[model samples]
Target: MKKTLTVLIAAGALLGAAGCSATPQLTNEETCARVKTVVSAQSATSDKAGMTRVANQLRPIKAAASEDLRDPLQTIIEYFDEAAKPTPDTAKLEDMKADYSAAGQTYGQVCGTGQ
Candidate 1:
């Protein structure tokens, strides 16, 4: 019960943070934009099922977007993993690679990527 509540709260907090809001940590726009981009890219490649799976997997981990790099990056990688019956988009994948690189660089320089 405790764990479930914690997860629910985290999901709600993250969902709220993604919408337009003034989260003291970082603006929701920043995190939400990244998540939107990732989801859009996956949808462009795979079927609805794949997109849904990624979205479902991402909901709980979504909180990491506003705080750290590792969790978001890991979530993005999970999206990549969930993609099915679709080929990778080289250009979009390149952009994702750069985003992941940014997160990794941040992790290397700052704390452990907000983990």
Candidate 2:
């Protein structure tokens, strides 16, 4: 009984340690690189299914971004999210385009892309 309890405690400790080790938040450079990759991938694909796939890929990168990059990433995410909606609204689409353009400008300024 004592041996079993000891083994259980060791297992619990190992699990606790693993859970405590969080993934490091992405730096600005890393975030920008990931964003660029996503953009390139998105641009390369013209179909609706491919766009949806790329949008899904952006979710994790958005979640991993540091606080400084969150707003731009969110804008990008919103652009895709709005695009993916079943019933599209013209006004909302226009707003999303403006927001996306603003976000792109911000991203360009920060990352020095001149876009």
User: Which candidate ranks first by TM-score, i.e. highest?
Assistant: 2
* lDDT values for all models: 0.56, 0.79
Strongest candidate by lDDT: 2
Q: What is the lDDT of residue 23 in candidate 1?
A: 29
Q: What is the C-alpha RMSD of each candidate to the true structure, in Å?
A: 13.7, 2.9
lDDT of 2 by residue, 49-98 (tens): 66566777778887888777778878877777777667667688897898
**lDDT score, residue 50, model 2?**
60
Clashes per prediction? 0, 0
* lDDT value for model 1: 0.56
Per residue, candidate 1 scores C-alpha lDDT tens digits across 62-102 of 65455665464574555465443267556666667766666
